[model samples]
Target: MEPSSASFIHLRIMQLVGYTQLYYCPKRQNLVRSNILVVYSIILCMVVITWLIYNLVDIEAHWRSLEINSVMETIEYINLIGSGAGYINSIVQSIIHCDKHLKHFKKTMEINKLFKQVLKVYVPWERLRKRLGTVAGGMFLTSFAATAYILMIALYMKWYYYIRYWLLYRILYNFCSLRYFESYMVVSAFKWTFDYLNKCLQELSFLGGKHMDAYEKKNRKFGLYLTEMNYQKQSHKNSVYFRFKILRNIYHLQWELSKVFNDIFGLSLLVNIASDFLSFLTLTYWMLTTMTTFSMALVDVVALFGFLICLVPHLLNLILICRICYLTTQSVMVMFFQASRTALFVHKIPHDPTNESHIMQIEEFSLQLLHQRITFSAFGFFNIDMNLLYTIIGATATYLIISIQFYLSAQRG
Candidate 1:
């Protein structure tokens, strides 16, 4: 298989986050790195986990000591829950699923090899590399800026009481950001593969149509016509059979790859989405509470800045994940339709034992596509698609209203 720019970028980023130690060694056609790095990765995860526990306890105590209103108190709790979820997700990715990550990485490489051999599609590695680099760089910069701004604000506000907690939270948040970016690249790769499959199916449809048109245009005597008809029928059948067979294998491989992906990332996705949702809820609630209690002109600039820094990244990350999942699923649907259309075209041709079997293969392929749908989900709880985004927004709004009501009641009392 040719070099993949996305894979290279993903590996580097994953390494930086201590998610994996393996690097592609082209000569060996395998991922190679020291087992010691794996041990180091485990140690890093342990350290992060330890710090997260300490920070959570410290922050909780600090929030309680503030004697804030009910709404503010609730938001603080939600914030801790969200941050905890994210930390747990990082732990799961780096420690528990470490071996699975290695196995899936190798499996995907093998699948890519098969795709190249079967489909013969040209992937623009250089273009992909530049695009992926820009995205990764942008995410890193945004995360860095957010961290730096918060640290600066902590200094300004003299938040010495929980400054350590903020530092630990930022570190954990950056790790989560790295994982999110890596997942995006993986889904993007899947999207690219599905697109190429769709293109292959389109070309197959065109070839079938051309065959049908040529057969109709030919003129021959009755006896000669019968002979030519049989020959043409057999030739088209053979061509369609070979192509469909290759496509079937590719589709099956894709299905297995999806399973591997789910195994590796399913729980992590669940917690990541949960973390983002909770964080978004907490930040939006805090913003709303501040606005209701004080005029915009009188709002604390440092607090407002903190809200923006936290809110924007979580919101953008949520949308990015949903959009990619939706697009990848759409590509799979397009492939399904193409296969169905190709099968219908084949059905119109004269039937023989060979053509009959070809039609069956096509039908089976279509059915497999429908039955074994390719979807990204949060451990089967809910799909990670655009609809999920809408659901999240609606849910957040509902909770925000409830929290505000509680605050109003508490003030009255």
Candidate 2:
């Protein structure tokens, strides 16, 4: 749409919003790493070392060997049941540790006076931390369960316990590495969403956010004109007035939908609930099928049962990716609504094909730019990696089948 006569401030905000979308990245590694996992592991080791030194000095070597094991055991339980303590700690440390990112974001926001609400990086970080922490917790528990199940399988197969440790830890290491990268993607998604949303809303404001410069003010004035046009006792067929009404409705719908995420950092909870529901289903399947062993049909059950149970999360993960795609597309819809309103408003005016064509061209270009500039924060701030999470499920199922088979066989023999 042609730049409305909104204020220059809002125009600048639009630019910032655009640039923000281009640059927004939560897990650049150079700037931020969830570090929660690394930190927790370190703390666990420290705590274990301290305890062993005091009480197990006589069995120092053996205890030392088991120190990591003990810590992992604790993490497993905490993750399995959910630890409010961990969640609380994430909130508390986010304030201190996130200071640099906050300062940087604030400094950047200061460059543009219009969007103070979004300038505070704390909100985004809070948003990111909450969800990332949940994923981490879920990962910790699932991994432990998978590893234990694997270990049991190896044991039933008569493998050495030491070998089990080695094999399991290798898998654990790969998981940690992949997860760290996945978290990066989530962070990237957050930044992308925030920047794009800020821009789209500011433009549609018809007025502006907290700050509107010359262009935005002009746009606002134009929007005001449209509003007034609607109020006048014009015919329903008055194209200009009708156009604004349609555009206005579309913008309203978009905003309303976005507000569903307005609970500060509540997206994390919503996504987790989704994941857990899927997990519940998958686990329930496994529990039920294991009972099928009571039937004489043993070989076929042995063949496919574990595999399907394991694939549960992978299947759910497909839905999650679709969800992320849908959300991203929905966000783009807000921008489209604005552009659509602009077009309708222009169409209502007497046709100046040249001017209308130019406006349409700009609208298309702007949409493209907006899409390209989308950041990570937007997509994954609260989203989990259902993709990589599939592996954990797969491991768990394989381990379960092998272990349970051995258990049943031993009983019969």
Candidate 3:
């Protein structure tokens, strides 16, 4: 963007923040309420005293004086607070404000610092500029035909004209919206936490706060007591508890970061899917709007620009989609290998406490995800390739030649 455009965007972000009302301040609410409550309470106390005096002395003339005093006191307190607010506001203004020249100087300094930071992360600005120029020049060539083709496809996306695309879009939207994997992760995290909290409550209730406090004063975080009397005993050297503590902490931290990344990844997944649909809608709308002008030359330029902006992103996302699939598959395979290795190592321990049950558990966990959480698209475009490849399974080289001949014959017709 140009400098002027960048400045406008910065101004708009500030404007968005400025327009919001100050509705969420608990401190401000308490400050105002405390002042009012103290004044109101005093007035009520004074009136009660006056009523007692009037009843005892048979005098009611002081009632008006009492009313005036209450209102005046309230007003005076409000005036004081308002005056203090004005002075505080003036002080804040002086601290943040400056002459125009100084303001510009400060802005320039900030901009230079930000630019330096950005430059540290990015390639040289001149190199970036040259690369962008080459990309733009290429975009000018293929953009026109791609734009026209995409616009035609979009225009026919309605159910009446193109039921297949509409159905495909619906399926994709629904598939992404399914949160089974994410929900499983959340439930697992909370299950571990809930179990820990339950143990704390169970022990603390019977032991009482005094014992708990004494226990905590000795051992911070979680103190696993063998018994109340044994709580004071020294921790065994190189014990099971000591050895497992390090591993537990590692697993605990991994669980925390796992939940966090799961959330971020899930939300990004949903957002990216919605983005694809919205992009389709937006490009279609742009195409329709530009096509309404229908002068061939103008349409050609509009189509070219439209394709460059719209089609290029979709192409990039296709590449991204393939990489995402490949990486996700590879990571799952690695995790499987880790689990298999862990099981083998643990079971081979000398004089293993876990014998019969350990082997069963190892096998069960290794296959658990395969049975319950393994996701598969049972139906897809690859179904036709199954029969063809199976028929020529012994000679794969013949299958490609057959497919080529088949495609050529279909194309000729």
Candidate 4:
């Protein structure tokens, strides 16, 4: 089957923005792309890295020249440093792990093919296409608004300041956004697969129910002394064997897909989440300080608007990622429960050697579900879920309290 047009377009956008070095060629069954783009991406990243280093020197010099007046300034400085580090880390990781990335991408494509061709799973490409369009449009509009706001504010600044704030920062921010978009797509793929797996399990239960119902009806028709017909028993046994085997194989493939996903994107996620947390902390602190201490002047109002522009996209990205991860993990747990229930249902049936083997297969699958669980995490440091969101909120509150105390102390002094 052909790939979804929307997915193809989304990936091509990634390629245009230097997020990906190669695109898959379905006809060739391999990743193929011009080396020119690869070279260009490398050069572009190198230029950005050099520009960042130059800006760091300026930041350090500016830091020395200025007095740290408030906790807000400290938070601002930290946020800037964290953002720069995140950009550099993402770029460097992409370059260093280029081969690993390609390998994993190919593996992901193969898994997708297996689902379509061998397992006969239905992927809701239309829904996914709509989602991709909605997310891309939102990111574009948010980035555009932020860029325009920066441009308006930077008009009076020096040439370098205008270029740094308006040009370089926009580029870097878009790069980070693309990385987040990529993660969203990958996670969505996993979530959809888990959904289909659950559906398959449900159908298996229904199949068992139908078989039992047929056996009961036949016994009533043929008199209570009659056993189930030989052909009917063998046919149900065969159907059960095939269905269980397919599900088991699909679950195993899910494990492989998750591993490949982590290998390709784990470090990038870690960096992205850290950058978001720092930005969230800084923005919250700034807004709190502004609201409590400062009067509502035009200048403050404009600054607040700019802060909102920055805050919304970052917060949205964070929440969307965590929410999807949480949903995906929940789906996996649902699959586990479904598998356990199916196993129990099979156990209560009359025992034959074939039935005994099917019970063992299901029990083994249940054990694997318990032990070899799938989780979305940031380089094994923490799982990406609603819990992570809660942790961020709690940590931000604690830090804000500390900063507020210092702010109060400074005022008194």
Report the lDDT tens digits of candidate 3 across residue range 195-309.
3323322332333334434554555544554454243422321122232232233233433443333323333333433344344433443344444445767546655564455
| TM-score, structure 4 vs. true | 0.87
Which model is ahead, 1 or 2, in terms of lDDT? 1
Show the lowest summed lDDT stretch of 10 residues, model 3.
Answer: 16-25
The models' CA-based lDDT, in order, is 0.75, 0.39, 0.35, 0.74
Give lDDT tens digits, candidate 4, residues 1-413. 13666657866776665666777777886766657767867887788778877876775566556553556446655665666666666766666666766766666666667667766776665777678678878988988888778677656333244345346556666778778878887888788778988998888877776776677678678875465464576677667767778778877877877876777678888998998898888888787777766668776777677778778778878888899899998999999999877876666445576446777888789898998888888888889999999999999999999988886787789
Give lDDT tens digits, candidate 2, residues 1-413.
11122223332332221111112233651223335533544464455345434433333344356563543333332322222222232233333334333343333333222232332222243454456456545655654554555455546556453343335333423232232323333333434544544464444344322222443355557875655444331332233333334333333333332332222223323333333334444444445445665465654454345434333433433344434534554556566555555444333333344545535543654555355433222224443334334544576567667756775687689
Output the better candidate (2/3) by TM-score. 2
In candidate 1, which residue ranges exceed 4 Å CA deviation? 1-6, 25-27, 32-34, 56-81, 160-163, 219-233, 296-302
Winner by TM-score between candidate 2 and candidate 1:
1
Instruction: Report how far off residue 216 is in candidate 1 (Å).
Output: 2.5
Model 1 lDDT-worst window of ten: 215-224
User: lDDT of candidate 3 vs native?
Assistant: 0.35
Per-candidate TM vs. native? 0.87, 0.35, 0.26, 0.87
